[model samples]
Target: MIYFYNLLLLILCYLSEINSARILGIIPTPSISHQIVYRPIWKELSQRGHKVTVLTTDPINDSSLKNLTEIDLSFSYDLYNNKHNFSDKIDKLAGKPLEMVNAIITMNADICDEQLKHPKVKRLINDPNEHFDVILVEILQPCMFAFAHRFKAASIGVVSMDAQSAAYDSVVNPTHPILNPDFMLPLAGKLSFFERVFSVVISNVMRVYEFLFIIPINDKVIRENFGDDYPSCKDFIQYLDMLFVNVHPILSGIRPNVPAVVNIGAGLHIQSPKSLPEDLKSFLDNAPSDVIYFSLGSNVKSKDIIPSTRQIITETFAELPYTILWKFEADSLPNQPKNVKIMKWLPQQDVLRHPKIKLFITQAGHQSIEEAIFSHVPMVVMPFFADQEGNAKRIVLKDIAVKVDHKELTKESFKSSILEVMENKKYRENVKKLAELLQDEPMTGLEKAVWWTEHVIRHKGAKHYRSAAIEMPFYEYFLLDVIGFLLLVLFIVIYVSVKMSKLVFKVIFKLCGGEKPKFKRH
Candidate 1:
């Protein structure tokens, strides 16, 4: 009986192994904000019995997740920090669409080079035995997508924010350039004619740059790492089985998405409120109902603000009745107000969940905005760069927040924006209403992401979900060939009709015995 029981146990273990898959996630971006949004995905997949190996810059080193393996690529941060100073350029490249695109494309190429050459990545590549059943790659880094093809796995694109126009087009989704501008552009709302023109120009320029510059760099990287026989980087788009974009109808306006695209942007990184630190809890507990939570998110540091703007912020905070919790990176802030509490880092979601909190002053990152909405807190959004400007526009349009332009920031403007969000009852109501809609989804973002990921794993690939539009030629997809044929037919009919009219006139004139008096050679 004991021998029979042991044999049954072994058989059960074998069945489980056959059912589970090996997933490789390449979230190689250096930003903490980007990594945090995807953390839940691998963790949940591991919990569900799949073996997950992630090449990541930020690894949640949890011993409990026995099935998860993390290959740390934290060195990418050194390259990122040495190359780009986001703080110094808040007033410069933040508003310039072309310059920003150039900067990001250059940085992605640089990071991709170092990432592919890293020792651990090379080991994974050279090991003939290594295989992944699925590859979840960050779509922003096109070079990373090569891993999907390298492993011969079903590829899925993932983004921490809304998908770029180029990525949308790659999957054959409509861009609606004027109605929904690309994430790189700062212009939002009903655009002026020039803004509309600028959007179209900038959007196309990015796609052209990706084709001419970015893809070549990616192709070169693939050859150096994978092999010379590796397929072209542009060809990888067709193998994309699904895209898990961090967007929702409430965040971005209602837009069409292909069947394979799933939105997991509804606070995927948000967690249940944890116990706040002692000092922090004391601060919030004793504060008034108008307490303010201020953070610029992880990528942008509060201590890095220019001196003049810092002074304006300090003075404005001093004048406000509400206590402020600021995520100041530095250990000490000179002349910090008594009512203001400064911490290098704070539990942002927990702080927002506090009952005493009234308003959030933020740089309007997508993740931060999602948290504010989840907590039903209105905002005073001072957008600095990237998608912040667009997010600020979205919330302001929804009437849940007031936008304070970073360039036009003043003590009075800052104070009034804060007061407006706190003093007005409608902002809170609008936020609550929007939050309800966001929360009304049938499954949470994590569930949707994990379910679809497993779905792709179960089926081996999702080629069926791929849009037929992706395979269509440009002329055929747009019906330009059909249009050209119709135009040609119309031209021939008009030409023949003109010739026939002239012939009829000649016959009539000849029958009437009219002489050829037409030639008056002047």
Candidate 2:
């Protein structure tokens, strides 16, 4: 009986141990917005007794989480901010498709180089004994997949936005250019002829761009940092077992996905709004009318906005009776209006949840849109770049928001959009309906993500879940070979039939004493 008890205890401990895993996350991008999408996932896994190590630009240094180890690459942020003014570039690259691709590739390559060279990351990479059950690399930086190969672990991709981007094509199911909008284009469902042509052209161009430029950059960086023995970037991408996309069908539109592509779009990492600071709470509680919250997201500082545009925005808000809460970085604006309030930062999601807040003016970032949808607030979107344009266009198409061109933001146009969105009850209703659909999911995004991460660990890569299409060549995927075979058979039949007819004719001609047709040879 004592021996039996010992065996039972051992079994129980083994069962408990099976639930945990060692997960390595490579989130080299310095953008705070990108970090927000991933931090909750890593935190949840750590809390669940799994060992989680992250090489990140934004590190959560909470001491209490014993299972989590963060290798800080925050220096990448300073390097990026010092080298480039992203706010100014947003305006310049808004409509230029080729330039946008070039800029994004350059930025991602630079960040990847910095992360691979960081001392802590270098040490971890070179350590032969270091191993992980799985490695999670952000999809934006494909070169980071080298870590998965080096660690001999299952690879999972975590994308901050929808999986419609060409960058994700290798890992996800096939994307139709006509049905699915590219990350660069703003058109949505039921596109016109011109739009369809443009979409196809742009899609092909992007694929070429990826092949000729992006992949080479990633390959060079991977070879440099991880050595030549590591697989090429494209080869590393093929080894990805699954992808977690932060997009729900309701917002991102319906598209076919393989089993490996999991949608965790509903989870926005929203916490219960903390008790508001006394002064801010007092200001919100005592608002005379409904409030308008305006923010350009984390990347675009208010001070960097052009002076004329700033004047137009302030003037437009002056006309509104509602209180205007602007997330301005500067301490003071020279001619601030009485109704407007400027803060260096604001708890955006919490503010949106407040009953007095009616409409949100935003840069139409993916996370911000998700937050607004969750809070059932309509928006006035001024899209800047990347997926923001696509997100803004979709919001407008859904009838839950109005769009204002940031470049042409005159006082008249800005105020008119705000007034239209604020006065319209339909916009509010549509957004609330969307919120219902988003919140109706059985599992939170974080819960789903964590469960899958453990699932991969438990199964040791979950290779069974991989799609057959991942191994298929472009011609095979489209069945061009099968089609060619059918065409060849038809040609043979026609050739044989023509020859038989000619022979029959010649026999008949000879029987009837008719001359056979003579052929002239060159």
Candidate 3:
């Protein structure tokens, strides 16, 4: 009996050891902000004993985590840095929705092609012994979905921004143009007649553009890399088990979401702030008054700003009593203000946590906005492109930030916006209230994401959680068939009514001895 009990214990231990899975993460985008959102997810899975293989531009090379395997695609980053003029593109693409979409699609295609051609990725693809239980892909680049299909793995999508319009198609959710506006358009709630018409028309145009142009390019790339035997991008979308989006009801307005859609917004990257470096701490501690933290995020380098705009910013800062800590990439700035301190980079989260930090001057990127909200720091936004404009408008609408168009920025305007936010305590109060609501969730975003990911792996694609909308055609989903039936019934009723009236009229005319009306056929 003793021997049998020991044998049973050993068998249970063995089962536990083999329970962990091999997770594959494909994040080929060169954008650092995107890397920031995805890195933590794979890292957490690795920490929990799953073997994680990540192909990314930014690799968190922690030697301590034995389960993590990061394939460095920093070469892609180098290519983008050397070849692309981001500042100019941002300037030109602002408010041009179609052009912006085209630019992203083209850029992502180039990156995806380069990623597939890399030797490490090629070897992984060719290796017959390799296997994964689940594959996590960046949702922006749909071409990468082929990897999930090829590996025969359960697929989970990661979006660094709010659930975009294109993502609705994957889960088969209704993308009502007015209710769920495209990320490019800065629209929310109750639009005027002209605005509503424009919204519907533009939204449909974008959908057509994606279908006609973007999907074909994606299909071509997948076929070239993975071969024609593989399923098309649309076919592979059905394999997606869940999508983790960086959206919160508190930050982004509440919208209808399918069961497979998970909102891990502020919690996606927000963690306990680490201790600031000594020099940075000293700088903040020594400040005479409250400091304003300024950064345009990693993608938008401060040096890229036009000289005149830079001068206007400097002049505005010089007028303020608050100290300014700017994330300027350059070694030095000409005519730098006495109160302004420039650094190539600063620990943003740590700085935001400081009590003396009064305001954040930001580009209003999703990640930056999340950080600001997490820290209860109000913002003065100068939005540039992509979702930044929408994010800025949302923050402004929430009454937690002031929006200053970068193109219209001047010393006076910049100074006034800053002063307005600083003087008004309501902005600070609103942000703090929002932070409380965000923190009040039942489970942290990270926990929810991990739970859902592991659930998919364990259940072999968690089909029960999938929305019923996926099985319905577009007409069926909107009950257009039902509408058609009602219309048909109405037509029959009208026809019957007209015939009855004509018969009654004829009888009445004959009874009254009236002349019959003559009908002419042309």
* Model 2 regions more than 4 Å off: 1-15, 495-522
In candidate 1, stretches whose alpha carbon ends up further than 4 angstroms from where it belongs are 1-7, 510-522
TM-score for each model: 0.95, 0.92, 0.94
Q: How does candidate 2 score on lDDT? A: 0.85
lDDT of each: 0.87, 0.85, 0.86
Clashes of each: 0, 0, 1
Candidate 2 least-lDDT 10 residues? 163-172
lDDT of 2 by residue, 457-500 (tens): 88898789877777788898888999999999999999999999
Candidate 3 off by > 4 Å: 1-13, 513-522
How many angstroms is residue 124 displaced in model 2 relative to the true structure, after the best TM-score fit? 1.1
Highest-lDDT candidate: 1
Give Cα distance to truth, residue 360, candidate 2, Å: 0.2
Flag clash pairs in model 3: 247-265
